[model samples]
Structures are given as C-alpha cells and as structure tokens.
Target: MATMKDVAQLAGVSTATVSRALMNPEKVSSSTRKRVEDAVLEAGYSPNSLARNLRRMNLKPL
Candidate 1:
C-alpha cells in the first residue's frame, strides 16, 4: 500500500505537501498539486474513506 511518505518521496516533495494536496488542493501551487496527483495516480493510492468519514462525524456535535 502506498503511504503518504511514499507519495511524498515519489513527488519529490514533503509529506506535508502531499497531505495538503490531498486535503486542500487549493493551498498548494498548481504544479506541485499536479506532481502530487500524478504520483498518487501512478502509485494507485486510495485515501482511507472510513477514517475520513469518522473524522467528519467527529467534527459534528451531537
């Protein structure tokens, strides 16, 4: 499985950059976002949907 570190190394950027690109693409430059996106596609990376959903749920108050 490709981790964020793997994507970062493949994209020649930091892990923080990969995270930013995935979570908030607009925060990153277009070229950097493209590099990160290409690396993710080439690596067949899939974000953890379950974890993401859980985080969203946690953000909402009961």
Candidate 2:
C-alpha cells in the first residue's frame, strides 16, 4: 500500500500540503487540491484510519 509520502512525492508537494489538501480543502488552492487528488489515485494511497485513530488516542495496537 502506498503511503502519504508516496502521494506527496508523486504530487510534487510536501506531505503537510497533501494532508491539508485532503483534510482542509479550503486551505489549499484548487490546483493544489486537484494535484493531490490525482496523485492519490495514481499512487493508490489509502490512509490507515485505524492507525490514525490510535495515534489520536495515544494508544498502541496489540
């Protein structure tokens, strides 16, 4: 599975930019958002929601 770093590299933007483009569309320019979206499709990246939630809750997976 592709990671956010892969998407960022493919999109020619920073990982933070990718996160902003996905989570806060209003924060990034339309062109930037489009690039990120296209890169996501090309890279076949899917965010690991379980890992994200674990991190948010400061819990470790068993």
Candidate 3:
C-alpha cells in the first residue's frame, strides 16, 4: 500500500515534484526524472488514472 507521499519521500523530493515527474516528465530534470523513476519502481508505485481524471473533471476553467 504505497502512497504518493511515500514515493516522494523515497525520491527525496516534494509530492508536487513526484506528480510532475510522473505526469509531465518534460517539466523535470533528467537526474530528477531518473530518481523519481527509480523510486517508483522501488516503491512499486502505480498512478491512479481514475483519480486523476476525476480531479481534472472537478477543475473549473479559468
């Protein structure tokens, strides 16, 4: 039962960095991307698509 926080902690970065690294790799550095990827594999992380879609659905257009 690994969480996003766990992945962030393992990667030595913030949760936002983990999200960016996962959702938008171009936004993160190569070294940070590698670290996040390694942490994801080590933590057996899996992004929850449904939750992400739901979150986007709830966002109001600016």
Instruction: State which candidate has the highest lDDT.
Output: 2
Worst 10 residues of 1 by lDDT: 53-62
* Candidate 3 residue lDDT tens string, 1-62: 67788999999999999999988999999999999999999999887777668778996434
Q: Write the per-residue lDDT of candidate 1 for residues 32-61, one digit (tens) a residue.
A: 999999999988888877666876788633
In model 1, state the lDDT of residue 13: 99
Best by TM-score, which number? 2
TM-score of 3: 0.79
Candidate 2 lDDT, tens digit per residue, 1-62?
A: 99999999999999999999999999999999999999999999999999889989999999
Model 1 residue runs over 4 Å out of place are 49-62
lDDT of each: 0.90, 0.96, 0.90
Residue pairs that clash (backbone atoms under 3 angstroms), model 1: none
In model 3, what are the clashing residue pairs, if there are any?
none
Q: Which sequence of candidate numbers ranks them by TM-score, best first? A: 2, 3, 1
TM-scores of the models, in the order given: 0.75, 0.87, 0.79
